[model samples]
Target chain A: MNITQLPFIKEIYGFLGHDLVAAVIGILIILVFVPLNSAFLVWVERKVAGHIQLRPGPMEVGPHGILQTLIDAVKLMSKEMITPKLADKFLFWLAPIVIIIPAIVCFVVIPFSPLMQVREMNVGILLIFSFSSLTVLSILMAGWASNNKYALIGAVRAVAQNVAYEIPLLLSTMSIIIMTNSFKMSEITAAQSPVWFIVYQPVAAIIFFISTTAETNRAPFDLVEAESELVSGFHTEYTGMRFALFFLAEYTNMFIAASMGAVLFFGGWHGPFFPGLIWFVVKVYALIFVIIWVRWTFPRLRFDQLMNFAWKVMIPVALLNLMITAIVLKAL
Target chain B: MIAITDIISPVLVARGAFWLMVTITLTGALLAVVPRNIVHNILGLALAMFGITGIYLYLGSQFVAMMQLLIYVGAICMTYIFAIMLSPPLELELPKRRKAKVITAFFVSLVTFIVMAQMILSYKWAPVTSLSRDWSIETIGQQLLTRYFLVFELISLLLAIAIIGAIMIAGLVRRKN
Candidate 1:
């Protein structure tokens, strides 16, 4: 029987019938997947970095250091939680929770498969953009609550970076939405069955990818949390679980952004041979690998340079791409 | 006198729940920006924005709701925190509200809200009867490229200019320092 047809599903169905049940299940899924995904990504990133640096990566700790992240997580959890004496105790505790809430919620509208999406909507693309922007605010909160000079500087850098990049990210996405018309992820994928948008709007695709990376605070664009410059950036004062929450949120966000790029430009869940869902995951992981590669390979852009690239380079390219796509589609 | 079927009505409960969420969101938003303590304001904003996301879910825009949380709560709020952190003035004691400023701002906001609300309520929203019922991502694409092509191009041009301007301004600021 199809999962949608299950009687148990009805128990948790309706607008308000068992929203609590739905929420609980949703949180459960996030909790299970986030840590597992973070572990896998951490291992993958290290291995990738190791190979690039010409050094042997982790060999011990459960099969080529696959268990390293788990060990680290345990160590982190066991450590004492610290709060600066000068900090506002209440807001300090609240900041991390605020960050994680959006990261988890973002997964809701993402179409993992046709049947796998938690909540499908007409405006899926807009939803993702809006929700992702909230991270800036949360980071700012974390920085302020820390009451540390480094944290403050990092938070300021983060705000400037996010605000700068957001324009290009939105513009590039607008090109896709113009080509597709609907903001729904599933619909965008369906439109690409005959031809993926990336084929026609390659420039937009590149802009989207770059802007998304910056948006997620990944390497090269990760000035907010740059260790060498800002001393761990905004979350410098955080310890134990609070810091873990920030880390988990960041990795999960990266996964979500990469997966979204797959859905938008790569014809989500569509491919010949193998199920649609399989194709979707393959594309997503491939993109994720590329992101990791970029992170390790490139030197970080200066904060000013980063802003300039987004506003001057990406935005214009994305706009021109959209215009060209629109005209071509119209003429055809 | 009670009807047996009345207890099971989903519509009533759904409507009630939606209004509750709306109240939570609006209240939270008010708290987020108005509070003297920057931290409290952020919390309030988060709560409010989360509520707005809930409202979006009800409006058949799950995607927008998710985006609202992700972008506003995750990113913008974080930015605000960073701003507070960076600003020395933020560390100062909360100032007492000036009665005149408070009254003027309140009246202006109230008037604006009422006017907008009235206009929205008065407008007639006509559904497109001839168009396909499918507002799926696929159809949106077809329409955007085929029917709304001009508008699409215009938006792109506008975005290009905005980007160039933002870069120039930021670059100038950095160079001066």
Candidate 2:
């Protein structure tokens, strides 16, 4: 949406060129939205996990730990951004920034509401998916650059895991895109007015949920950063703000993945009584809450089992689902 | 805020950006060839592909740009990285004869470039008068199925064969282990 639609913004746009005005506003939105949303999601995850385990989370911080993540953010910012002396200096420095860029860029095309989006590209879903895949490259860089065996192993596992799960993820999403016949996020949402896609494409929805959890490195699929096994995985040597950027990007990715799920299967922004933005947020959070809950509930999967499941089961199932979807679409 | 048009027109900005992309593409290509490190070479190739994606975007082919990013940077580069990381590290030392080989490679590439440039310059390119302006995903799908059906099927068959070949090679290694 054009910020210049507002009278005050229109005045500013008259002084600045429209391109500059839009560019500035888009940057500002990402700057504010990414960190703020990440902080909020972190708080929500902690609170939900705490309650799930029958304890109050961050009670000492402001009421119900609302201010806890803010305090943590402050602490993280003050800590040292240490670089390992023997590490590849260029790649070590580049990895965290590279990881975060894709996470932030994906937000630009996300249709938050009918009126709220940075840019509504025709290939929005494709753009997000393509950029998100770049995250594995950063992870690999981070791991390899650390000059640590554990970090390298973690990176290898991450690349393997992401590469395997991505097939199922794309296949399932292709099912929905086939039905909707467009890659645009807004069109996908609009097409779901009659019924949420979860009803018709339950298998795809299930596969999507599973792969997304793996995609974001959450819980069961989080072998990339399995603390007990790999000593904090790919970001083992990263500290302070560098670590915080990875942490923030992880949460932001979780948010984006869930938002995509909501948009694809949960009838994004389509609900009674409430406005579209509110409904959209509600659906997204509901998915995020489920993700967090699942994280706290399940044990991490074995590395070999993860690969086996992706290849032997999920890929075939997702492919079958796609074929059926195409046949049905053709018949209709 | 100074108006961008006051210093340089929009067309000038676009032209400048186009040239910048071309420079990036060439530099990346040079890096891919000149780097001794295999990883650096892979990353340089990725950079070149990304610059080409930018060129595609400027040419009003957003779909193709996204696909290029998806297939080349996301899939192909990652595959190269995986193979690099998985395989044993190579010895850095090269044979003396490699210098002559490198010169021959450079000469061949230069000759090819000149031939391609001459061909491009001599050709009187004309836009197809009946070309459909629709660049949407739907139209692309229709064209692929109707106009390019056999070629599309052939490409899919080729991909399937490649995948099977990869699986067989990987299986051989596993069997050896």
For residues B1-177, write the lDDT of model 2, one tens digit per residue. Answer: 776456655455556667888998888898888867676687788889889988887665789889998898888988888788766664556434577888999899999999999999999976543324777677888999999999999999999999999999999999999
Error of 1 at A41 (Å): 0.4
Restricting to chain A, the TM-score for each candidate equals: 0.92, 0.93
TM-scores for every predicted model: 0.78, 0.91
Which numbered prediction scores highest in DockQ against the true structure?
A: 2
Where in model 2 is the C-alpha error above 4 Å? A1-23, B1-7, B90-97, B126-132, B171-177
Q: What is the DockQ of each candidate?
A: 0.25, 0.38
Candidate achieving the largest TM-score: 2
Which pairs of residues collide in model 2? none
The candidate that achieves the highest lDDT relative to the unseen native structure: 2
DockQ of 1: 0.25
The C-alpha stretches of model 1 lying farther than 4 A from their native spots are A1-30, B1-12, B29-34, B42-88, B92-177
Compared with the true structure, what per-residue lDDT tens digits does model 2 show for residues A231-294? 9999999999999999999999999999999999999888888889899999998999999989
lDDT of 1 at B26: 86
DockQ of 2: 0.38
Supply fnat for every model shown: 0.37, 0.38
- Number of backbone-clashing residue pairs for each candidate, in the order shown: 43, 0
